[model samples]
Target: MDLPTTLAEKIAALSDGPGCYIYKDAAGIEIYVGKAKNLRRRVASYFQARDGHPAKTLRLVQETVDLQVIATDSEVEALLLENVLIKELQPRFNIKLKDDKTYPLLAITREAFPRVFCTRDRDQPEVDFFGPFGSAKELYRAYHFLMRVFRFRVCDLDLREDDPGRRSFKPCLNFHIKRCSAPCTTRVSQADYGEDIRALRAFIGGRNKGTVVSSLRERMKRAAGELRFEDAARCRDQIQAIDRLKERGRLRDYDEPAAPTIDIHAGMERLQAHLGLAAPPRVIEGFDIAHLQGTHVVASLVQFVSGVPNKDAYRRFKIRGEAGDGDPGNDDFAAMR
Candidate 1:
C-alpha cells in the first residue's frame, strides 16, 4: 500500500530518540502501541513493504491512519510507561502480558528457620517474595542451584531455634545428600543459618553481589589456609557456578533502580558530539534474539527515546520456518536480514 501523505509527514517528523508510538485506525481509535529506541526508524518500518512482516503487522499497517508518540528520559522509564499504557488502552494488536499472578514468586516465609519456596500468593506481608518468574522450570533450576550452594533448609519441619529437642530429630534425605543445612537436627546453628539466608537475600536482590562473591572468595582462601582442601574445593565450585549464572544474566533484580539520576540532555549532547552526528540520537531502536537453545526462536525490537526505553513501541516476531536452517534455532543474521 502507498503511504498516505499525512502519515508520511508524521513518519518523517518522528524524532530519533527512545520513546513509544501509538498507531490509530481511520476512525481515530488506537490499533497498536509500540516502543522504539529510534522512533523514525521503527515507525517507518511499518510503512515499508510487507514482504517479511507478520500477518498481523501487515494488517495493522494497512489500517493505521495516524500516529502518536510519547518520549521518555530512559529506556527503563519507557518500559514502565509502556506497560501502563498497554494495560490501560488494551489496543487490538497488543499482546496481553502475564502479570504477577501468572508467575511464581520465590518467597522466604517469616519463621525461625525461614522456609523458602515458590508461591503464587503474596498472602503475608512479612514474607519476602523475590520474583514472579515467567518460566517456572528456569526459576526452579536457579532455586535448586542456590539450595545446593547455600545448603539452606527446604523442608517445613517447624523447627525453631528455641526448641531443645530439635537436635534429636533425624536428618532428611536432602540433609543426607548435603542439599540442606540440616536445620532439623541443629547441625547448623541459628546464627550460621541466618548468615546464609542473609547472603542468599543479598544475592537475590542483585545488590551487593560483589560483596557476597568477595566473602566467598575470602572463605575459600581461609579454608585452604587451614588445609581444609575439601571445603576450599566446594567454595571454588560454588563461586564458579555463581559466576556462570551471572555471566548468563539469569539473575534479575526487579527492585534495582533502572539508572542513576543524571542529566539526560547533557548525556545526549555528549553522545552527539562524540559520534560527530548531525543531530543527537534522541530516538533509537534496538533488536535482540530470544530462544530456548535453537528452538522457539524470536526477535524483539525495542525503541528508546532520549536514551530511555519506550516499552509501548516494543515489537516481537516469531522466526519464520523458512528463515531457519534444517534445524530450528536462532538465526540472528537471517532475522536481521
Candidate 2:
C-alpha cells in the first residue's frame, strides 16, 4: 500500500509493546479502538495487503487518516484497558455488548432470615444485589448453587424466633432435607447465620476464585489451630465447593483474573519518542465526529492522562451552523473549534 510520508513515519514509530490503538478518520474521529500484544505488529498489520483482510478491516484501513497509541506493560493490561475504553468510547466499528441495559440480578433480602432470589428491578436499596448478570438462567443457576452450598432459608413463612406461634410451625421439606438451617426454630443462631452470609458475600464480591479459595484455606488452617472444628469444617467445605465449581466450569465470568501492571511512565516516554515531541505529553485528547447520513452531527472529545483514559475530562459537542447543515461531509474541525 502506498501511504503518506507522515502516516508512514507515525506507524514506523510504533513501539513493540502490549497496548491499545485508536484509529481515526480524516475528521479526527475515532472509528475503532483495538488492543494488541505487540503494538507495532498489530497496528501495522491493518495497513498491509487489503486483499487478505476482511471487508470491515479494509473499510477501517481506507478511512484511517490518524491514530493514537497507548502502551501497556502486558497483554492482560491491554485487554482490560481495551474493554474500559470500548465501553466508554462506544466506537463505531467495535462489536458492542448487545444488552446496553442492566440485566437481572440476584439479591439477598434484608430480613431476619434473608431470602435469596432473582429479580429484574431493585425496589429497595437496603437489600444486597449480587449481580447485574448477563442472563437470568445463569444467575438462577448460581443462586441454586448457593442454596445447595450454604443452605440458607428459601421459604416465605414469617416464623420469628421469639414468637409463640413459631413453636406451632412445622418444619418444611427443606429443613428435613437439610437445605435450610431452620432459623425459625433457632437451629442456627443469628451469629452463625451471619457468618454464612459473610462467606457468601466473599464468594460473590468479584474476588478471584483462587484468591478466595486461598483465603478460605488459610482461615480453615487457623480455625483448626484454634480448635474451632465447626468453622474449620465450614471453610474446608467452601474450598471443596470452589474446586467442584472449577471442575464443572460453573464458576461464572464475574470474577476476573488479575491484570498485569501498566507502566504509565514508560508508555508516555515511548509515545513521546514515537510522536517526535520535544517533551513527554502529560495529557492527550481525542476528537471524534459522529453522524448518521449527515444528520445530527456531533463530536466526542476524550482525554487521556499518561496513556490512560481520563473519563472525567470527556466532553461532547453538538455541531451547529455549517457543520450541522446536513452536508455530504461533516466538518469535525469546525465543530471542535
Candidate 3:
C-alpha cells in the first residue's frame, strides 16, 4: 500500500490506544520509536497545525516520511514491545539509557557449601540475585553486615570436598572474624552451612527484613533459656549486627536500582563543561600508566578547551615508569596535589 502523503491523514487514521509507533525518514530508516496510551490522540498532536507542536516536534513531523503503529492489549505490553523495537532498530530519536555498570548482587552457588559473594552478571545458574545495587561501597557495607550476622565462604580459592589435599591449606582471614564458613578448609560441614546460606538468601530477599532478624532473635532467646550460652551469644551478636545497620539505615530490605555511566569526550567542549574550571586547562593532556608491579604500563591523556576534553584532541601516551611508579608516588601531599 502507498504511504500517506500528509501527517494529518496518517494521524487521523491511527487507532485510539495502547501501541508502539515508529517514525521513519524519507530513506525509510527508522529514526524514532515510541509508545502511546492513545495512539490517535498522541500521534495526531504532531501534525496539529503547528501551534501545538514544539520546534523539535515540528521538525520531526516535517521530516517524518512515514509512521507506523503496532497495536497492543495494554500500555505495559506496548511499553515492552517499544523496548524490543528500539533495541533492535537502535533508532536515532529514541532515548537509550546505556549504563553498563558491574555492580553487586548476592549470589548463592549451587555447591555443597552454597557460597555467597558480590557478582555483577546474572549468569550463575545455581543462585538467585538480590540486586543490581547502587555501588560497590554499598554492597561491601551490606556484605560486612551480613558477615557479622551469618557465615559463608566468599573466597576465590578452589577448595573442594572431593579433594582432601587442599584441606591442608592455610586458614582464610574470614575464619578469624567468623565471616566465612571456610569451605576452603572444611571448617564448617557443607550441609550445615548450606542451611545457613538458604536462610541468608531468603532473609536478604524477603519482603520484610525484620522477619529474618526476628526469627534469629527468637532462636537466640530460646538457646539462652535452654542454657546454651555460646550458641545464644552467637545469635545475640547477629541480632545486634542487624540492629546496628538497621539503625544506620544501611540495611536495605529492598534493592536499589543500578545507575551506570561511561565518560566519553568527543572534543574539549564536553570536558570543559564537566571540569567547571574557570577555563579549560591549557593543552589539558592527562596521562596515566596501568601495570602490575613493573609490568604492562600504558598511559592515556585528554585535551580540553572551555572546560571540556576534546576527544579529537585526545592523546595516548606509553608509560616509562614501573608499576605503582611515578604517577601515584605514594607521597601524601604529592598524592593529593
TM-score of each: 0.43, 0.42, 0.39
- Whole-model alpha-carbon lDDT for candidate 2: 0.65
- Find the 10 residues in a row with the least total lDDT in model 2: 254-263
State the weakest 10-residue window (summed lDDT) of model 3: 259-268
Encode model 1's per-residue lDDT on 1-337: one tens digit a residue: 6877888888999887766789998999987877665778988887787898999888898899888998753333344345456656778887534344766677887777876776677676778876555456545555666766677765535678889866566564455555666776657668657766877786664335578788879978987998877657656766775676433422232222324412233356667899998988967798898778877778899876655445667899877656455434567776566
lDDT value for model 1: 0.67
Number of the candidate with higher TM-score, 2 or 3? 2
lDDT of each: 0.67, 0.65, 0.58
Tens digit of per-residue lDDT, candidate 2, span 187-208: 5556667666666666554333
Best-first order by TM-score:
1, 2, 3
Q: How close is candidate 3 to the true structure, as a TM-score?
A: 0.39
lDDT of 3 by residue, 49-105 (tens): 776767777767677888888876444334435645765787776543213446456
List the candidate 1 regions with Cα displacement exceeding 4 Å.
Answer: 1-100, 219-237, 243-337
